[model samples]
Target: MKQAADPAKERYALMEKIQMVDFALVELTLYLDTHPQDTQAIQQFNQLAVESRDLKSAYEQRFGPLRQYGASFSGYPWNWGDSPWPWQL
Candidate 1:
């Protein structure tokens, strides 16, 4: 029989991927600021942005909002408190 996946581990892994993609996006933003004519970098940045957004949405649907103060939507009963906080992960 196959074993079940661990929720905490899965959550942590997804969060790590989002962080990596977001970090790359930020770096690309800074680079593009200097090299505005680089078409390849621009394309890469756009791709990463979409990937980051999708990852965050998937994570939020499974766990909770990755941000607060209207940055992310919370489910009924306020699920922000339902999952482990970033620091706790």
Candidate 2:
């Protein structure tokens, strides 16, 4: 049977995925800047952008919108609305 997810745990997992996508985007960007003819790097950048959008969509679906200006997400309203609190772990 599938288990219910813990909100804190789920949020942390999403954060990790977002971090990975962030890194990939940066890496691809840097690579493309130096190697503009690298078709593989361009392909990878396209893939990373799609993946990042998916991750962000998932995050916004579960929690509030994290971005400052998203289509469907209102800005975080609560003071402590971002992520795992320092003591949550």
Candidate 3:
């Protein structure tokens, strides 16, 4: 039988992916600022934005909110205080 995946490892991997995508989106934004007519870069930026949203949603669903101050939803009992805060990773 296959072994179950480690939640910590999975969370790290997903966070890394989201970070990379977000970084790329930022670079694309800067590029687009200078090259506003670049349709290809615009498309890429839009695609990555959607991917980032989806990845963050998945992470929050499994691992808890990635932000506070009304930026992310919290379930009952206010789970933001749960252990293993983002910096602990």
Q: lDDT (0-100) at residue 50 of candidate 2?
A: 93
Q: What lDDT score belongs to each candidate, Candidate 1 first?
A: 0.89, 0.76, 0.91
Full candidate order by TM-score, most accurate first: 1, 3, 2
Q: Candidate 1 residues 18-77, lDDT tens each?
A: 989999999999999999999999999999989998999998889888888998998998
TM-score of each: 0.91, 0.77, 0.91
The reply for model 1, stretches above 4 Å from the true place, is: none
Per-model RMSD to reference: 1.3, 3.8, 1.3
Candidate 1 at residue 78, lDDT?
Answer: 78
lDDT by residue (1-89, candidate 2, tens digit) is 99998987888888788888989899889889999999988988999899988987887677766565335465456423565432342
Worst 10 residues of 2 by lDDT: 78-87
Error in Å for residue 46 of model 2: 0.3
* Tens-digit lDDT track of model 3 for 1-89: 99999998999999889889999999999999999999999999999999999998999999998878998899887999887776666
Candidate 2's C-alpha runs over 4 A off are 70-72, 75-89
Error of 1 at 6 (Å): 0.4
